[model samples]
Target chain A: EIVAAIETALGGGPLAGRRVLVTSGPTHEPIDPVRYIANRSSGAQGTAIAGALAGLGADVVFVTGPAEVPPPAGVQVVAVETAAQMAEAVRAALPVDAGVFAAAVADWRVASASDRKLKKTRDGIPALEFAENPDILKTVARMTEGRPGLVVGFAAETDDVVAHATAKRARKGCDWIVANDVSPATGIMGGSENAVVLITADGVEDWPRMSKAEVAQRLAARIASALGG
Target chain B: EIVAAIETALGGGPLAGRRVLVTSGPTHEPIDPVRYIANRSSGAQGTAIAGALAGLGADVVFVTGPAEVPPPAGVQVVAVETAAQMAEAVRAALPVDAGVFAAAVADWRVASASDRKLKKTRDGIPALEFAENPDILKTVARMTEGRPGLVVGFAAETDDVVAHATAKRARKGCDWIVANDVSPATGIMGGSENAVVLITADGVEDWPRMSKAEVAQRLAARIASALGG
Candidate 1:
């Protein structure tokens, strides 16, 4: 249903005509004009996924946060900072064949962010009211109309990733959940390699510890298969 | 007082015998193994400052957080993710002639960051308690013992840059405050160019719109002059 033409990378493959939306990086929730709340998501995996999707001949709309890496060439990029902006960007880029929600969207944002920079006090700390950020994947997954044919979400956990991700699949109402253990001991949070579990309606499948690029390629292949390409 | 023979870049000049410390980037205060709070600091200005300091023949100890840009070459880079770690790195790199606090340190960290990832709830959002982060600039500026001869702090403000910066200089007890407006209208925040107001004990000096590199060079020159280089 995406009438607007999206620029895709060179080389037509199995997914040549398909359009995909990919969210990458850590979403910053503004606390003030100069300060924000964010996470340690380097967006390496997300970036790799976007590239993989593009390589598979999909027109990739890369919606990213302030990621460490620059956007990969030959994709339509929409750069947003805060979670709300990211959600809005995601919605705007929707009505695609498939969607990947890989960004570590902050669960909460300051309910009332200060327009001015919050000043430091001698003794007292500022009381920040909190508001839950929109669940982008859930919103897209539950869409009654114009939803992407396949929707994916990610779960970064420290313990019991499968059990947690299994529950998350049901909770978020997403088609699949890519779960990974991000414990410091795993050296996966900011590291280059990742071991993930893919939970679907069928069951959970464990992926071996591999380079993020490999993971992306395998996941992209799976997407192609699921989409009957 | 830096007895350890630290490495210095080639071609000693105005800052040949001086040691300088610079802080940049945004600290990621962990909310969980995978979630954190951070600011929107690109670390461009701080990297430029460190490069400029090194260009002036100063032994630069660059303490940085999770930044978008990579650390500059020929500087002692101490990378950290949290505000506490940044403060510790700064302390360890101390006994310097000058210190530039450019890092956008998160004001608060989760009071008790959960060991495991908080799950997606079906009903309501999780409540996150926050605690004040260590005041890195204030701590370094107020140090009577082994205090850096010249301490400079940055104040990214949106309104009344000079007045707020002047007050911040007095309040934080720092020697000078480099204040800039970050209102979206200015296109300064996360942008390459900056227009700043340098507030000192003498008076406020307005710096023209220039690339962050130029600002760093000028500031480095001022530091060299103050150190009687």
Candidate 2:
């Protein structure tokens, strides 16, 4: 740890003097004071990515939700609960060299979320109205000014992984897309290993299944290369 | 730990030869393959209660959800995710001397839960249809043939704690109700210390704020006395 800090201080690594932003974990959308909607993201991969970036001497800002895994060392950590909170935190951590949007942000939130716990009534079960959450990746990617040089988005699809991710990359106008299949059979949602396909302007590169840390290391190296470090 | 085990084997302590059932944690109601509804229950109090009962030489059957706190040692642990699974698990561990329903089971589950991840579309956000979950506490409490001699329900209320808990006890036909205010200001929802009110046919007993372990020990002693252990 001390050696890494010293190296970072001396600007020794390829990503030295570069600033990067990462959003990790699963954003929780509240239904009431006590209840919320959540996903199966453990933040293992995202945490690993932030650690790898820091190891390469990048000053990292990590905005995360309620994750099972803790934030990595040597990064500015901004902890948030809801998707809206995460979006605000991301906006506050702007103008970085690269932005990695890895968090499993909810698509919609409870529009009629109650401040008080909803009681079971004779009428019937409560109907939960929905409201769309802000598209953080697209907002950052399409920014005309003060935008990160490289905006990498993640696509966790259950079917037609390549097609869905490719479409997502184009729709969001992101520089690259890290796509993965999160079907239960894959055992990758909360698992240590990840099998991902990287989609860029050139084409797709299917990466073999490996530990989340290894994936992070490789991705960090690619980011360094892309930024002409 | 060895001493406790030896004592339990020798049928020692006040609750020797007795069997007790406990349900702990917050039940998750799935919204989709990756998303679900959850609460802020850490299961600290419930785990401590189960441990205390086991320490009193009771054969403890602990049915728990995906809680932050792990189940106590020296108990049969039945892990579950949703309220339906928890209800089934509770039924399977029945015929005990006492039953404690401490889990914050969801009142409703998403009836329109999807097998596949719902994608964002131009149309709008998805509306969630809710269905009432089985009332586990009331079901067991009203069971005529094989109901536990001592049935205890829990009420996590934000307002009118005593009145709400008293009504809950009567409505569920349970012998006792453990009530606590879980308002965000209380800091008791996910905290170690708790201030609770115990409601019974005799009336309400307001307990001073204390560590969850202490509360559990006291409650277990009361259970032992009521069961004639």
Instruction: Write one digit per residue (lDDT tens) for candidate 1, span B165-215.
Output: 888899788998998988988988778999989988899999999999899
Q: What's the true lDDT of residue B80 in model 1? A: 97
TM-score of 1: 0.88
Candidate 2 residues B97-191, lDDT tens each?
99999999999898888988888667886667788899999999999999999999999988888988898999999999999999889999889
The sequence of per-residue lDDT tens digits that candidate 1 reaches over residues A11-66 is 45778889999999998788887777777688999999998888778889999997
Assess every candidate by TM-score: 0.88, 0.96
Question: What is the alpha-carbon interface RMSD for each candidate?
Answer: 1.9, 1.1
| DockQ versus reference, model 2 | 0.76
- Alpha-carbon shift of residue B170 in model 2 (angstroms): 1.3
Q: After superposition, how far is residue B206 of candidate 2 from its true place, in Å?
A: 0.6
The TM-score leader among the candidates is 2
Highest lDDT: give the candidate number: 2
CA lDDT, every prediction? 0.87, 0.92
Each prediction's RMSD to truth: 5.1, 2.2
What is residue B31's positional error in candidate 1, in angstroms? Answer: 1.5
Q: Which stretches of candidate 2 lie over 4 Å from their true place?
A: A1-10, B1-10
